[model samples]
Target: MPAALHPDFLRLPVAHRAWHDRAAGRPENSRAAIRAAVAAGYAIEIDLQPSAENRPMVFHDYDLKRLTGRPGKINAFTADELAATRLIDAEDGIPSFAEVLEIVAGRVPLLVEIKDQDGAMGPDTRGFEAEVAAALGTYAGPLAVMSFNPHAVAAFHAARPDIAVGLTTSSYRPTDWVFLPAAACDALREIADYDRVGASFISHEHDDLARPRVAELKAAGAGILCWTIRSTEAEAAARMVAHNVTFEGYRALIPG
Candidate 1:
């Protein structure tokens, strides 16, 4: 069997984008939302992408219009520009990845998802994957980096093997990998090839846990986590297959 999974990582309920509750005035990935998660005692999960400056910024979506009402790509702005942009419904502005680490202050573990638009290997891409790893260098907290792109994961591992890393995957459909080459799409659909990237864990889509490779990994003791668990029914389903869950919308069902 593989080594034991990190106890704190498995035992905690991770807040998807920091317990975002827009109706309550906190927007997803906002500093206010993150603070709410810290106060509520849930672990945090956030996305990181590079600004035009190549500094890691705490935000999701390749485009900024959804969350910020901004009209350009997120990477079009520099870190200072992004920091000045406020979330649509909240006063808090976009924050740097370093700022988030400081805000969490090791109060709880963090799962940092590195959004990789460029599928380049190694640190040459100047994408958020490398920047995220670089930013994490001085952080003295429990954290893990994950990505949908295997090349990004492998490249980050090559740069910083000390940090925990994982792969985020789902059973792929045509619409999902439309941007990728056919061969790449075929490989991603297999999902178990995550080992190519040295992923110690797999944060799989909750509904796709029944894939044979996933079951095989779980049986061999690889840490298996699931994402965006929103309701009691989904949580119950995920609990049966995943060691931990990244959840939102309501309080997660804690494990014994």
Candidate 2:
């Protein structure tokens, strides 16, 4: 793996969300947030979703009520509609994935979580993944693609093996959240299966890092990345325990 995509994420602590300080101009998934992360010397990880017209945009939620105060589904709005919507974090404009890429350039590696809910891909998504790949073609920095939907990750990896792919899970979802289901195995078998799927890393909620399955992942040549860590001290503690990298709400951890 390239230094940028190294299995060991310990080199730079990742911020889960972009440095979106509502008071400062940093809005999650906005170009401003990406710029802030670059200025702070921290790598960035962001979420991608297709707008109504199938254009790729930087956003994390399926609904727009929280960020935009506009009650509607993200996929229900066209790019122009989304563009017209302002981030509730002080009138910051929502940014396109391309715009964010331009701002960050190669300043820091990026981990993109592609939205593949319900198997929506290709033309159904206006070829969002292909567009993302095209945008990334202009970037020289390290890049990794991830998804909670295995099919999405598989599709991206099959198309572009050059970029590493990670599989993410959360404790809340009983079905897909757990990599290995009881039918597969009651124990650590799920982690092993995910590794078999060519996943370079396992990104899970911070709490999941404590499950006994983590050791199984380590043994399978996979790395551990915990998500949404908000505090520096919590990050330190997680690193000491099981996580090799952390996404703490968009702030990259700069080593002292």
Candidate 3:
């Protein structure tokens, strides 16, 4: 599939895990959370993983115990099996990727992060790339795919160069590469490589917000996005310091 023309993701502070409220509704990647984000007029970022039957669903953890109280890996159960499992404390249930895209249709853009192998890209990781690409074919709104694994992003780009891809890294490491403790040289090298390979944006942890290295990347025209900010103060700080901010559980912090 060709990459679709994406809108400017820099416009709004994206909600990293949707607007999740465990007590009032489901948490991240649940249907309720995605809906809440749409209602709040914020874009959302979500993780995509497949079920045992090769169905794509909105979820984060590899195991089901944390969210569903089920004792197994997400890939161990079919979509039907997952649907039968109750999501902890929410009135709504786990949602398939198709369902999520349908509900949020044309409301807000989604930054779909493919959780790569142990936070790095390697062959041992499951083939989430193919499933994600397949599911995305059904989507009709603005969307971008991001991953900490360059290989994952590379694979997705290879499959669909038209879709905007964001390469995620942490300041704890260098931005040039996707691995931990990435060297500065590696960051520069990778930025060039990603550009040559067609990545549209770059996302890094907030800890790297004020670093000179971040400014360097931004100067080079890599669309910058900072993540996992959980407080209003942090969001404010990010807005003052970064190009785009991704906050988890703090949609209310964004001014209407």
Error of 2 at 116 (Å): 3.3
lDDT of 2 by residue, 53-142 (tens): 767788999899998889989989988888889987655667888877778786777778988655422124345666667667657666
The prediction achieving the highest lDDT against the true structure is 1
Please estimate how well model 2 matches the true structure, expressed as its whole-model Cα lDDT: 0.68
Question: Which one wins by TM-score: 1 or 2?
Answer: 1
Give me the displacement of residue 43 in model 1, in angstroms. Answer: 1.2
lDDT tens per residue, model 3, 68-169: 877788888888878777788776667888888888897788888887654435445466787778877856678899887777788778777768887776
The lDDT values for all models are 0.81, 0.68, 0.74
Q: Give residue 185's error in model 2 in angstroms.
A: 13
Q: Which stretches of candidate 2 lie over 4 Å from their true place?
A: 1-4, 119-128, 173-189, 247-253
